[model samples]
Target: MVKLLFLLVAISFVLLFSLTDFSGESPKHGESMMSVHLPDFRLIPTTGASGPESFVFDISGDGPYTGLSDGRIVKWLANDSRWIDFAVTTSTREGCEGPHEHQRTEHVCGRPLGLAFDKSTGDLYIADAYMGLLKVGPEGGLATRELDEPLRFTNSLDIDPRTGVVYFTDSSSVYQRRNYIGAMMSGDKTGRLMKYDPNTKQVTTLLSNLAFANGVVLSQNGDYILVVETATCRILRYWLNDTSSTTTPESRGNYEFFAERLPGFPDNIKRSPRGGYWVGLNTKHSKLTKFAMSNAWLGRAALGLPVDWMKVHSYWVKYKGNGMAVRLSEGSGVISEVFEGKNGNKWMSISEVEEKDATLWVGSVNTPFAGMYKI
Candidate 1:
């Protein structure tokens, strides 16, 4: 009986040690699997027949803020708070055909992608995929194109207040926004990150041949720039001070992969005034989805089928591939916390503005509820 008891004890010790080792060193190859219970959040109920695509607080103005949706931009006042169309997009509507027919509003044809307010000039810098970069000033506004060449598919935009230099991403050189799915399915790395100097009127390519470069953000100190390579599931860093990095004309600076092996496809990223940057995850990466995406032939064949059939197939794939978010803190390689957004559907781009206290006014491209929360 003593010998039998000794053997059982020994077996238990070995199992315990093995379990501890595995749990300690387990790598998060796909989803973080670490679930987070966020604070109770609700949609700040938007009315008046508008589907706001993006929201930003006007720093220059007081009380009310601005939201860009569909074909119109609306002003939302906090006091006597009501949303009204401040500026309706009534620009040229010629090339707005086919899939982008919705963009051709009776007022505006081009869709606004990214927006930044120029500190020194008080002008709003807009990056429209079809219209390139534009400057819209106050007084119910007029827009003037800053760059002559229209972008292939311009995305996120940010301007450095100190240097007056603007940075933006052209998602794909070969594939436009209408065919965005085609570009992603093909895993085409034709995306480019660019810099435009307002002073010199010179545009330079920072990084090229990126796999769907989506978001661009300057570091807090303006030392390094972070650009997201969406399909590759990584963020690349470009050093502004390192001139001896590379001689290639397409080189922006000495770039290194900042963060990699994200759980899902990264859409947009924004720097928080408090600290850490928030990344918006569109869809979960699943093995089945990866299988479909792995082979070009399979992806093409699937896409060639009827739209409903393709969607039903994708629906099952998405069930496996889902929720993820990462917080990158102060240029450090370490990601602080990972948050899962929604249970079923993915949460696309996240646009945040500062409100009272340190609360973040959050908005999503696809989320049904848009509200504020403390991280």
Candidate 2:
């Protein structure tokens, strides 16, 4: 009887250990403890729209053009201190008036996530989550679709200033913008990094099988392009010279690992005028989220549970108000400095950080207003 009872207790322990998802130890927040001073941020409210996911400036440097939730790309008029609608990705503008329309009708109205410019021709390139890659001339209105192939979730992009070639990310081939959270929770690995050439009007897939590829930026010398994989918390550098090859785990020799195990899930990366790159940490990494993601059974079980319940148990809910951003050295990919929000008024869900004239222009996907901080 004693032996039987001991066997039963051991089986129970094994079952509990297998079924329960205990939180993993949290990683260090930033790369180093050397503190960097961050100035207080001031908000620049968008007139009627929200969620300026990315930004780019024209050759004249007249504006920081940003894409909003209401399916319009607006430019900040520093002269008038107001946002003016510069372009629209979709022609269907009737039902896309309100800000909340993106939640329900983003596919029909088009949600433009990334914005870039062909400095040589004054053509603005946009990555619309629903409409694929597009471009509008200097006289902006209804932007014309450039890429014919379908994309699941086009997120962010950057253009090579010299060649006018564009590089961008398709966040997930399985999930659209509305189901982005589902893709993240399920650990989808179908993201892609692609390039578009203006001269030939061709689209080429550079890399595939990525874990939520989010951002792309060309090196100053145009030798390599840096791409961010958000779910894996790493940055990948693809060689522009090796255009004929496709990158994968097996073909790892073709590309280089730029950065790994970042402090947070990185979103958009922009070239800083002062040199190096500014990376936006949408949110800090949570130990609980990591534990849940580490286990395949726990991740699958999460799909059956209520989304609100799962969110409450996740790290994002627990650390709702905090935000972080980092600056990395260009060639070494070293974390040179870290910027963080103090107190409960955290920057929260930073989508992009555009650096200009020693000021950081911060945008958020969840917030209604964009912010500017003087460095």
Candidate 3:
């Protein structure tokens, strides 16, 4: 009996060691401040709306059109100071009434994410997490689904100003937005960067097998595209002038590494009028979480655990309610400035940043209000 007990103890020790290989190193906290200052902010409340992940203006520059949790694309009317319903991505409205319904019925209600405007046509393009890429006319109502065949998680997008061609990212081919946490822990590399031509309706794969491809933005001259791989914490650039076309899934375009070892997982990137780009850091990276993710078996086991318990173990959850944004110089990829939220006024999970009229408009996926800060 003693020998049997000793064997069991040894087995337990080995299993525990395998499951709990946490790196003692901690993730670097963002630098407190440098050249950027936290501007004065006011929250624009979206009545019964949640998760305004992105924002775009019409050709007239009259709106900050955004998609809410209830699958409705709404426009903030400056005259009225309220959000008016503009378009619906999904026709089925059953059980899609409240702000939190998306947590349960996203597949049914549609969770629209990225929003971009075709400046020439005055049409709005949407990246719905569940319904795929969609377009709505300037006079919005029901959005027309453009591409749904090869997408699982349609995350963010940008449209070329001159050609009107749309570029977007599929966060994961294996996991939907609802299971995003699972996709992150699983080390999903099936994400992709794709382009859609409105004229031909042809969808072309620009790059594939990305590590959770998240944001996409076209260069100022439209010569190249920048895509963020959130899982690897890196940015990749794909040259549009490359005439060579390869059909491989791993390598699809003339791609080059742009930025890596980011302090946080970048969510969305937008062009800044100051000859640079604004990147929103969803949350600061955690070394413990990175260590946990290195082991697939441990990640799978953690998924089986209770969600409340899992939240405690998540790095994002540990650093919730903190905000960080970085400004990178154009082409050079130099860190120009950093913007952080003030104490007691944290802007949690900022997914999009838009600069207009000397003010920065910030949108969050987990907050009820959109923030506006004058620079």
Candidate 4:
């Protein structure tokens, strides 16, 4: 009886430790700010929507535009204390305009995941899961689809203001937005990073055979691009030399690992206000989660289990802090971190962390409100 009790205690520790961030020594207090300093933040509800997937600010910096789960782009009017609808991804609205999940009406009503803006033109670009790339002018109403080809799982995007070029990612060819869990678990590698040229109205594939390409962003000066590979828990960098977007022998060589062996599964990455980049971790690294993700056969077999795959998958991946956020330097070194254990209920499944004016705008993929944390 005594040995059994001891064994149970050991198991509990393993479960807890796996839910923490990637393996690394904590940075010095001067080099980085630890999350212990982060307290409860102010909440901004989504009104009738949920899942503020990603956030962006326009050229004038007057708005923090975000895409919603129910297929609408909303802008937060701080002074008015309200969220107003600015755009929608799909013109067909038979079952849209209400709260819903992606598994049910994403294909019909459309689901916008990534949002970006062309600072010069004041045009908002959206990466919709079902409808591909979309755009709305400064006025903002019903966003129009702007892609010649279809992108099944348009995850995230970033724009180059200098050239007005749009760079985005398609999570997987086999799985659309509705079944992203299967894509991540089965280790699908058909994901891609591509760019769209507004001048020519053509899309070019930059890199292929990726393990779940999630968040994306350009350098502070638009010199290179950084992409998050979720399944592998690393960031990949592609240097830009010219306007060439197609894949070539030399171009492929330019793609290299910017950061690797991340402790948590990185979801979205945005440029920090001070310097470096802020990467949001959707889930901490757990033993069960790592084992299942590493073994393709095991992951596929688990899908056949009698239980609900989504729920089962969620059980395998646990969050220790309720949420984890990290800021990386220009050289991909860990600078500071935040663990939302104190108020994990306020946010989880973090998808975007936008820093502005000494505050971190925290958005989650499964939460209905955004949390504002002071830096």
Candidate 5:
């Protein structure tokens, strides 16, 4: 008991003090930058399933549609006051039914991670972990597989409205969602940031050898896109076109940090209605994570131990009924913030959070329901 308490207290200090940035750059948003009140999330239950990892709205702004652990994509119907089935994944989900299917049948049932909708075509594109890229029409049904080659762990995505091209991430070839803890700590670098061109029906890889690529979001005007590297706690920017006078095609917009040294490890990123972007911080960015990311041997040693790395990592961070998220400007400055977990509803570990019509819609990979907090 004494050892457990010591571990908790030591990690708390690490979480508190790690945000001090020494480099004279733009102001980074850490735990210290938060100044808003914690939001009390109103639960939106998924009936009997969990892990709605991504939230996306249609062009008409009718949905915050999400995919579930049970190989189903569902949308919230506000007028009917319930969630309705929108689409099913490409994997054959013959035995995929019940809560927390991720523990056993995620691969068999086709676990969908990221979702986006094309404004021009009204088509919903999905990045299913087991079945690669898939899409459904405006009238939802069984999703059609988009890619010929399989992706091991397709994570998140966003659509460019003007061009109708899709940007997505392949998390890792070595690790699937069933053992994400291994991917996070094993120093695996098999991830990629890719795009699918609808006109050509071709998928192209823009960036390769990414470390745990998790979320992908195009900039507000589609100048460039940002992809979150979860293991490194930083977001990378890759330009699609040479807008700047100094940049050339050969440069490839290499090694640009959109945001770095984040307070928490990011999951999904989305555009804010007001300005800037909203990032879903899945867990605290502790010193162990920072050191482990830099030193491969330390990461492997920690994972090699007999201890359950998932539980140790979980206990190393705090929920404590204090959920939080951040809004960042294009310059990486904190514009607005929200943090709360009231009434036994713990949303501290978020998969994605987006603001539309003054409400914060939240998704988590570990929860049975999505959450809503009105401003």
Candidate 6:
């Protein structure tokens, strides 16, 4: 009994000491932790109205763009903050229910992850984790599924105006969004980067075997597609029009690494209207924690322990810096420093946030207030 007591004390001391070293390393260049301040937008329930997940600004200089959890899309008037439901992601009428099916019923809403405006069609393309890739009319009406069997775990989507093609990523082909942590614990590469042709109605795999493919975007020139490998703290580029590279075999697709190592695991990537790309880091990268997460054997063992037992040995990771946006083209894609969470600033789970016109609206997974920001 005395030996067990001494062992517990020793373990606790070591664990506490280790946590002291787990501070945020550094903010990306030219970035500082700022408080987020947002407007007070009344939270409207989805049963009677649309459940907005994020917000975007109108490209035509009209107003704010809001995305809903029930799969409905809306346009918000910034002057008054009044919202009008424009499109619904799913027509189930039953709404989103259960882990397997996430469609909208009268009472619930389907999960709509990412939203983007296409310059060519002037329409909205959304990536629904369960329902696949969807497009809403310019006027924001009913949503139509473009790809039937979109890779599971579809998170973000971006369009190249030049090629008229859409690019997106699946975080894990083997796991649903709810089970991604388990997928990472398995150390399996089920993630993939995919492209869809609007004309042919065909979706092709551009890259595969990613650790956790998360966000995707097109270069300013539309020459390459950049995707985020979240679990691995890396970003990959798929060349669209490059003629010089023969490093990749035909079977594996002609994609090559555009950028490999990022400061953190990027979530949703967006091309800034001003310049550069904005990437949301799921969580601040921790060298010690990541080393353990990367080892499936060790992770499984730790996770298998009892809840209380695990708690005794567990370490809590608080992300000092919530997330940030970066410019890859300039200076070989130097990312901005981490954006701290505060008033008027953006928060995590930004894929759920909407960006239209100049306002950036985001809904939180576990936050006191949902976001309504002017970018």
Predicted structure with the largest lDDT when compared to the true one: 2
TM-score to native of every candidate shown: 0.74, 0.85, 0.84, 0.86, 0.83, 0.73
Candidate 4: list runs displaced more than 4 Å.
Answer: 1-31, 36-39, 99-102, 242-252, 311-321, 343-346
lDDT for each residue of candidate 3 in 189-271, tens digit (9 for 90 to 100): 99999999989889998889988999899989888888999888778878888763234454445877767767677889988
The full ranking of all candidates by TM-score, starting with the best, is 4, 2, 3, 5, 1, 6
> RMSD in angstroms, all models?
12.0, 6.3, 5.7, 5.9, 5.7, 6.3
As a whole number from 0 to 100, the lDDT of residue 141 in candidate 5 is 92
> Against the unseen true structure, what C-alpha lDDT does each candidate score?
0.60, 0.78, 0.77, 0.77, 0.76, 0.59
Clashing pairs in 1: 89-107, 89-108, 90-107, 206-252, 284-322
- The residue pairs in collision within model 2 are none
Weakest 10 consecutive residues, lDDT, candidate 1? 17-26
lDDT of 6: 0.59
Task: Give the poorly placed runs of model 5, Cα more than 4 Å off.
Answer: 1-40, 243-255, 305-323, 333-346
Deviation of model 2 at 248, angstroms: 15
Where is model 6 more than 4 Å wrong at Cα?
A: 1-22, 28-55, 95-109, 244-256, 302-331, 342-375
Which prediction has more favorable lDDT, 1 or 4? 4
Residue 155's lDDT in candidate 2: 90
**Tens digits of per-residue lDDT for model 1, 18-122:** 332211112345424334244444356545332243445556654233334344455666676566655533455354333332523422465566777777887
How badly does each model clash, as a count of residue pairs? 5, 0, 0, 1, 1, 33
Give model 4's TM-score versus the native structure.
0.86
Per-residue alpha-carbon lDDT of candidate 6 for residues 1-375, written as tens digits (9 for 90 to 100): 755655564464356436634333465556544345534333433333333444455457564565554455666565765666677777764534323223223223445666777777788888776777888878876688887684577777787777678888777877775455556556668888888889898888888888888778777787777787777666676777666345654313456555555655566666666566666554455554456555656544443433332233222322332443334443256654234354434343333434445644454332323455454
